[model samples]
Target: MNALLSKIFCAQRVLKNTPPQGEIPDDETLLRRTFRVAWPSTLESFLVALVGMVDTIMVSRLGAYAIAAVGLTTQPKFICLAVFMSLNIAVSALVARRKGEGDREGANRVLAQSMVLTVMFAIVITAIAILFAEPILRLTGSNAETHESAAAYFRIISAGMIFNVMSMVINAAQRGAGNTKIAMRTNLVSNGVNIVFNYLLIEGHFGFPRLGVAGAAVATVIGTMVALAMSVLSVAHPEGFLYLQFQKKRFRLERSTLATIANIGSSSLAEQLFLRFGFLTYAMIVARLGTTAFAAHQVGMNVITISFAFGDGLSVASVALVGQSLGEKRGDLARIYLSFCQRVGLFCSLTLAVVYSVVSRDVFRLFSSEEEILVYGEMIMRMVALIVIMQVAQVISSGCLRGAGDTKYVAIVSLVSVACIRPLAGYVFTYPLGMGLFGAWIGLVLDQFMRLILTSIRVRSGKWLNIRI
Candidate 1:
């Protein structure tokens, strides 16, 4: 026990330690700067994640099939959004670098070029997703009873792809430019709209039609539309930091700009692909265990994702801070900021870990009262509580690397751990090992730790400091 406690303290010291090369801000200054950027992003992400959980809770009212049906569309939906998602990473990093360089025009150019590419890709992917929705869901382990409902949900979501991707790219640029509050405000209003509509549309309350599973999808799309409109208005003002020029000439894509975007986005795209592939495979493995298991898994996943939001929000701060510092030729400051971001993330993760563990069973009950589901979900939540610590650390680590244009390394890690390790491990544990859903979660735990170790090593090596965009 003494050895264990010592090791834990050692780890905490290492995470909190900052390099001496930079004139580090005092603790109060560091905390204020970190929270100034992080809180809005964190709140935005938490609200967005909360909306997903709320969606599950509302849909669960229609029965397990409805829950499973909605869950089935998740991976395929992310799969379709993969390209834009990767591009948005580049957008955020490049915009931050430009902001630090004091090249406002370059930042706006990055925003415009990203928007152009996103639209072109969104159209093609959206059409394909809608056309092949049924076959895709079936391939994802959807069955006779769930396939039709899942397909309908998938199609509605796909139909709104343009709006979602556009808003996402713009918001990414906003975050990179140190304008997190705009995105947070946008999501706050939009998610509020989503919840209100969910209440009215799901079971025909307040004279709204009963659309069932499709209603959830529709509510989500409506929220995205609102988000897109707000995102555009955000950049429409000519005086804003990331304004979008309406002139046709300003929209012209330059080769150098395109090359820069491709340089960062291509690798991040590979990472996104690997991430979605691994996650899709993992979700499919759990789905094969039947609706009750999948519903419980989905609920557990939704709950765990809330913890992820804290890390993700802090990661947004890390990316902007690291990229901007690097752009200003302050590698020491970059190092210091990332170290501070990781420490903040670690604190939040530990807090969430305790909360999830303490209320594990009660939390699952909010979604379902089935005895088997309650049993499976409780165990999963306990595992998730432990996973958040490593998961958040790795996520922030990856963000730091990506901001420094070390996306190739991050992508390689994703390919190895997420695409390769997770699915294989999950299958082996779930089948050969006979650990059931718990076994699959064991696979997830391994994946997060592997990522954390690799990313931590890279961050410590400090090689990412020299990478140029």
Candidate 2:
């Protein structure tokens, strides 16, 4: 017992000293810098998630059909915008590296090329969505009663895809430049606008047209347009850190820049596609259980996504710090930043897990008064509490790898765990074992654990440090 205690003491000491190998800043300095970048992003993501929850709560009053209608759109909408979102990841990483290298022209050029790409992709995706919204809804397993509302919402939102994509890319560029406050403010304003309009339009509170589900779609579009305008103005401002030159020469598509961004972005795109496909399948499986189950699942998802916002906020910081560190040829600093982010993510997740576990019943009650929905939703939230810490760890690690231009590995791992394992496990648990919604959540927890293990392995291997954007 004495020898064991001595070994435990030695391990504790080693763990305490084990940051990445390099001269890191003092803990206070590191924490300050991390929060300087992280808080704005965290606030923005939390506000976004809050808006989603509000949307769910508001629509829940409309009935289960309304909830399922909106929920059905989530994965499909993500699939539609996957390309633009992935491209923005590349834009963020490239802009960060250029900024670190003090190459303002290079960074601006990346922005310009990214804008051009965004416009083209947005136009194409919008056209496809507008043309195929119904068919896509049907393919995603929307039932007869829900698909009509889903299609209407999908069409209107798809029409405004350009606004959303542009807003995202511009904000991503600003984040890469370490100007997170702009994005935060934009999202905050947008959320406020969305909530106000959702109230006015959904139920026709203020003599507005009672558009129902279409009202929610319209509100989102308008909010996105407002955000797009804010982002554009910020970048166009002369005193802005990443102000665009808008010269004809600057607007020209540089093949090398395009190729480089595409190289990094393709992996991100694949990862999103894999994840979305898995979600699509999972949704389909749940849809088979009927409307109440799916609605309960959506409510559970909205609440769980709240935890993701915190992790994602830390992820934004990781991307900025790690990308900048690598650009300065300081792999050690990159690793140190990643370590700090992981610690922050783990703590935040633990807090969220405990809170959700304790108050989950109350939280689910906020979204629905239906006893059945509330019961299942609470169960799902409890399952979420069990897995959120692992989920956040994986998300932050993926961000670190992304900043280091190691997206392909992340994509591959996601494909294996989320895309492949999750749906398969979900089906087995939900149908073969007859565990219902509980089984589906078990599959989700397994996927999170798998991702946590895989991403932790990749980050610890330190191979990402050598990857060059």
Candidate 3:
């Protein structure tokens, strides 16, 4: 076992054009550096995903329509967040670079500008989402049974967008500055709040009104509000690496900073658009499979999301470590760190794959008791075990590229694989081949592998090291 694990984690052995074994940091040193940042972020994301799965379990008791209704709001919520998501990517990358360059004020400037943009965008998007909630849910393939509930959930969630986006931008900056523990703490508290409220309001426990689907949305919003407060406080300390200056002079945005944000964020926005479009279309295709199937699909997705949490946490570490290394003009170290990240990501993915395969049936049973839903969920989750291996690797690769300011390449990859190939393949398999939910998942699997292949090629070429922010 020790020998096998050694082979799995020997990063330099697998990477192309790597430095000599003695040139890079020893394995113990790399592991400590990586996990120092990774463990908190990993725990944060895992807890949040765990809470989300628990939230679904609670809602599942309300039946398949309820689960489907909640699921219907998923893509639209992310779509609403796309702008800030893109901006935050820029914030994290830029901040990490500035930190490595030892320009404290520049990092803070990036934070201020991103916060300003997040606020302006959030307000407009929130209003649009609220006004057009019905049409949007309908477009997501919401039927009469789930439409009204989904719309209510969507509207409530949309109204709270300001809090969520604000917290997100702040957390992004924190992560880039290598202050990952702050964001982790904030999210952990936030998820805790969400679960408590969900218990109180979901089924009317402790004299609370039973709000059902609407309650879940309310719980989520309330949690984000808490997170926003904690995030703001995190940077309020004067001695912190990232201090939030509220004064007029310090808070005003500069044209050069905005231009930099635009340079990186524009491509990131394109990537987000492609991802959302492809995911939305794929989801709509599956929704057409009827409520039970979609519910099972949602459950399967929730389980897969648990695996995604680990990948996302590691990806955050990669972005910060890679960006900082490049800023310090040590491209060799950047490559080394990236390779180590990939190795760690592989270990995590393989571990999750095994666990998912072993307990696929029991995991589905946690969400529902229906024989048909269980059967569908088990098959889809078995696929998830394979998909996660590819998904984690690609996600980390993309993060490494983005950290190097190679957003355009990642964006192009998303365009070709996510926007074009995924949905097209899904449609053919679902309708033409009559493969149903499982077919849609095959498209997802294909998408992950395509991304892994393309991004791996880009990483091997080593051109991203020369790209400048």
Give me the candidate number with maximum TM-score: 3
Give the CA lDDT, 0 to 100, for residue 182 in model 3: 94
Error of 3 at 60 (Å): 0.9
Q: Which parts of model 1 have CA positions greater than 4 angstroms off? A: 1-25
Local accuracy of candidate 1 as per-residue lDDT tens digits, 1-469: 6565344333235435554554656545655776788889988998899998998999999999999999999999999988998999999999999998999999999999888899999999999999999889998999987998999999999999899999999999999988999999999998999998898888989789999999988999999999999999999997899988788877788999999999999999999999999999999999999999999999988987899899899889998888998888888778767877887788789999999889989998999899999999789989998999998999999999988989999999999899988999999999999999999999999999899999999998989999888
lDDT of 3 by residue, 1-469 (tens): 7677566556566455555533566656776898898888888888889999999999988999999999999999999999999999999999999988999999999999899888889889999999999999999999999999999999999999999999999999999998899999999999999999999988999999999999999999999999999999999999998997798877677899999999999999999999999999989999999999999999988988899888888889999999998898878778878887888889899999999999988998998999999899779978999999998999899989988899999999999999988999988998899988888888998999999999999998989999888
Q: How close is candidate 1 to the true structure, as a TM-score?
A: 0.95
lDDT of 3 at 122: 88
lDDT: the better of candidates 2 and 3: 3
Question: 276, model 1: CA deviation in Å?
Answer: 0.8
Worst 10 residues of 1 by lDDT: 5-14
Arrange candidates by TM-score, descending. Answer: 3, 1, 2
Separate clash counts for every candidate: 0, 0, 0
